[model samples]
Target: MGDPVTDPAPDGIDEGRRLIRLGGDKGLSLADRLAERFHRLTWRTPLHTLRLKGRYPLKLIAVPEDPILGDIARGTMLLEGVLSFRGEARDIETLDLSKPHPKPFAEYLQSFAWLRDLSTVATRARGAPIAEYLMGLWLTAHADTQGGIAWRPDMWGRRILAWTAHAPLILSSSDQIYRSKVLNALAKGALHLDRTADKAPAGAPRIAAWCGVVAAGLLIPGGEPRQAFGEAGLLRALGTGLFDDGGSVSRSPAMLLDSIQLLTLLQESYAARSAELPETVAVTLTRMVAALLGVAHADRGLSSWQGGGPASETQVAAVIEASGVRTRPLRQARDWGYQRLAAGTAVLIVDAAPPPIARL
Candidate 1:
């Protein structure tokens, strides 16, 4: 009813408009800056682009002409509002490190853990940053609460907590205090899984696999701690759970690419710290990449597989670059998951599968 706050904030508005324009240039045809802000805040990347390498038909999931951009913008706004000032909010009170948290607070902390994963991909969303702060707050507040953050019953919540296991190992290395909290939370989470295995859903194996991954990641940082149990479980789960013949356990093409992206991050994290990734881990990863190349459409971008994926070839290129391994180019003659490189084009995706699986 009143003038929109976005009508002011010259820098924010201009930046928002520029981001919207960039999306438009890529063919999203956003109607206005407000719409663009919505897309930036929520979708993170264009949904149309996310459809790359996906198998699900986009038309079925399309919202009414209104689009999802509005939700993104609102989320972004919340982030800016919260972060406008530094340390204005009071420090969270210390909690008893030895006890379990109350149910509601524990649930919120679990959600906060999940938000960190969501925020990683939602970089452009205003909600992205807000989600980050909420996650940090939840962790800070609940670390000492009764039950340190544990797995929630919901699938999405479990996925979020599972993913957060990597961040502390990778990003919190310098912050021993934070890192220690992460270790405690991870152990608590694993313990909860162990206690409730019988009550877990049929798909709980996936979550178990991730718990192993988190353990593996943590071990890498703690001076390659000789935790035989955790390390063995991680290797087993990654080998068995993360991949399928087509590439990823989750058939969502977007998810497959995301897995690759995460692997690249993990690989780089280890390399940056001068730690060695296990040989079995490296071999499995290479096999995964080869399988991905097998399915990649001719343009060097993955064809839409099941759900959604990145449209840009840039993502795949980044993965390849990070891998530090030379990928064999797709052959023009075969035409199955093959990319043909002519004089001008650096890469092109064609549906040509690679010749037979080679032993790693």
Candidate 2:
């Protein structure tokens, strides 16, 4: 951990290259294939469909914190039938909702990440109907179980979180039939998450799917097994995707922020039940907070690294506050490959290794 300027030439270059080759050609393993077959068989059953159409969780374990100003502004625009997502916006009426959407936006729409913003509008009397109308349109267009972007694991994961956190907003409609439909859809989505959490591609998507599963388990009544499954999957994902030193496997700052938020939500969910937080969850959160603090610049913002965008100081601070952890910045990281140097009034930071292979 000496000064980076005087460090020896790094080792493991060839090992890295060899590892990359091994990873590049790797296909689904036998276990994965078997799991996929099980999923296909289980997901197609009429009993599963009937289960989805039944009663939903009567109460949510947690409601997401209130929307910020940005959410309100965007939500207002959405009420006007204008769709803005992934830095692109178009009139909802102008696009063909029946067919596939353009790149990024299609992914965005399918993910329903924008539902958070829409929930802000739904809090208002005038905006609630608009939110309901849009939800109805999307459901009619993309509720197919077999094939559709909406049914993708990652997309469904995000959608489940959105629908759960904003249940009050989505269920505000006067039409009891539509309310039933929304509840049924949410149940279906949760079931889908439970079935596919393990099959989800590694990293954030996998983590998200498990989180959704955990949320469903906690909120849905008579779902002890589902809740246990969700908790176990979430813990497993967290263990694998997060390093012992608290950095994410992907080495992305945005991912760190997202992880913090996810953990916060889970913590709140446990709190809602007056249950003890898992030791694994508590320990990982503490480590993640310290790692996040290590990467913060003097301006209190995270430096751009690992292809992550510049995160605002406010955003980072909010995440840390949400974690409820009090920790100091890491002065030296052995496994994480970062160094901090200070001399009188001057301070410097250095990246001590190549980007993660996944980033490459």
Candidate 3:
């Protein structure tokens, strides 16, 4: 997907390319890698680890509902040890946390977000043990390694959301020690997210990180302070990471989908608590749904625009349904970055904005 300039018109896409040249929505640079290495080393110090030892919400105030629906077939596949996330599929047997992997798949594995999918299985009794087993494996591998990928701010955030929303599945084991490990892991993750969420890269990753923080705050007993802290960060992220028009800063349809999905998971926490939805969150969802619909074709599949591919209708519909926001597709975008036109069976979508800046 080149920069979205026009819908196959004679007009060239130099404007989008010019924007890309200004920064890096294209790929991470050497500076990004070096700074991350230094930061990782610095953050992994003994003192840092000690600070991370703060209160682990040892028990849940309540189990959250998993709003994003999972496919029964996919859930069964996850039981068979094949994991899928955001269209990325890889064998669980082949997963290696110590080695490099695709960003999407690694996020899926490290975060254990697949629990959302596995929960869709008709027989919870059949899948609970496997979920427990996976949790055990995660603990054994990354429990003590705070510097590892599993402890990445966004990964921790994602894990917190998963473990909390689908708590019943992972917490199904009656083994006291196993239960302790699970709770301890959740505590560690929430604490880690608290410390590092602000440092998460802007856009979908930051949203995921903050969503985890909020999830922990809501479900963890005595987590009011953390909840407050997380909501502040989330609001800040939304302010910067999205255009007022509800489009993602990244201008990628995929990013919009991810933001919706992450926020929907957070809404589950809100619902479980019977808490009022934050006004900002409510508004953001409304705007985002409108913007997302701008790129959605008549078939309800997302049209590829600005370095993204057309997402399957099933996936798009699932995210929209899970969002529970009824909004019409936007006809025009404001930093949300697209223009839509429709006439009977004809529809044309144009990318009217530059790519997202690197810092975003």
Candidate 4:
């Protein structure tokens, strides 16, 4: 067969081109590259080697290949550099062509080796379940500015739900091991805090709160309650953590957008299971939507102001719909996610109406 039909439709196509122009050419390319590069780097391993240096003249010793040992050595390096960017000056909004340093790009920088290896693994699997599983792992394991537990682990948790949520699309019989690893990592990250030492930021309680969102999903699938406590605790924090005016404690537009997304995801996940959200959480989410909507620009995206991270139209919509808030659009933040619709821009026209779709 020829190449798969991965191209997006007309509305999505225009939105993408518009995205490139608004976001920047370099960032878009980097996101695509980040996706491809990760799939490549993780497919294989080299023979194990042992180095010995002492007063005696000794050379390196060849040893039997051990996947587990190699994994530990490489994993430690991966975790360190990846984790370091957590407290750094990075955020997720600029992970594309616009900002000098996007969080996704940082993922590319910190774990290029792992990403490269992952890319290879994906190619070999080629349209297989392993590819999706690995891709989600690459995206989730990536360290955004939130550091150890935020986006990286958050993505891990989300992707697990995504897999479970859209099981047929991502998981199948051919990729059982891939599924196992993804699920296991998500479970471990959700339930086991001792696994990583990254702590919540001083300003935002949502970091810990978002962990609860992830833990909720992880607990559901694993049939365990250990993860649920943190999930509930995080929700409690998110309910109180979000400011009275619906803004993030950080007050960065980028963070505001991200927090909106985190809350929406949590709410939707619970809603999917017919769970009742705490009234405070619901109120906070609604307030946040109003606050973010107040600040959005004409283009339906944020103004890239105040050292904002990357905020896109899609993310904005997802949050808005998830928040169950009433909204109106401002032309300035057209690309801010939900603001486009709020502004009366027919997303189906811009996102769904396009033909002969574009591919990154």
Candidate 2: the clashing residue pairs are: none
Q: Model 1, 88-181: lDDT tens per residue? A: 2212233232346555444433443334323443443333334434445545655333222343323222432333432432232345564455
Those runs of model 2 whose alpha carbons end farther than 4 Å from true positions after fitting are 1-73, 94-98, 119-122, 342-347, 358-360
Best by lDDT: 3
lDDT of 4 by residue, 1-360 (tens): 743322111121234443212222232356756864453332222210011111221111111110111123333333332211334432222223223455553543332223322222233234233335334544454411223323343344333333333333334446566565444443443443312112233223334335444434433443336344555556555544444445454445677766665555455455555564557666666656765765665445665644566566555665575556664322222233222334344332112111111221
Give the alpha carbon lDDT tens digit for every residue of 1-360 in model 3: 643322211222234443222344555578876876677776668877787676555579988787667777678888888777667776767655567668767777887777877888746798788788777777877887777677788888888888888778888787988888889878877887887887788888899999999988899888899899999999988876787778888889888998898898899899889995698788788788888888888788886776777788899988888877876778767566677888997888887777677555
CA lDDT, candidate 3, residue 126? 80
What TM-score do all the candidates reach, one by one?
A: 0.44, 0.79, 0.86, 0.47
Clashes (backbone N, CA, C under 3 Å), per candidate, total: 40, 0, 0, 58
**Top-TM-score structure, candidate number:** 3
Model 1 Cα displacement at 335 (Å)?
18
By lDDT, highest first, what's the ranking? 3, 2, 4, 1
Winner of 1 and 2 under TM-score: 2
What is the descending TM-score order? 3, 2, 4, 1
Q: What is candidate 2's lDDT per residue for 134-164, written digit by digit as tens?
A: 7787778766454455766667776776676
Estimate candidate 4's alpha-carbon lDDT, on a 0 to 1 scale. Answer: 0.40
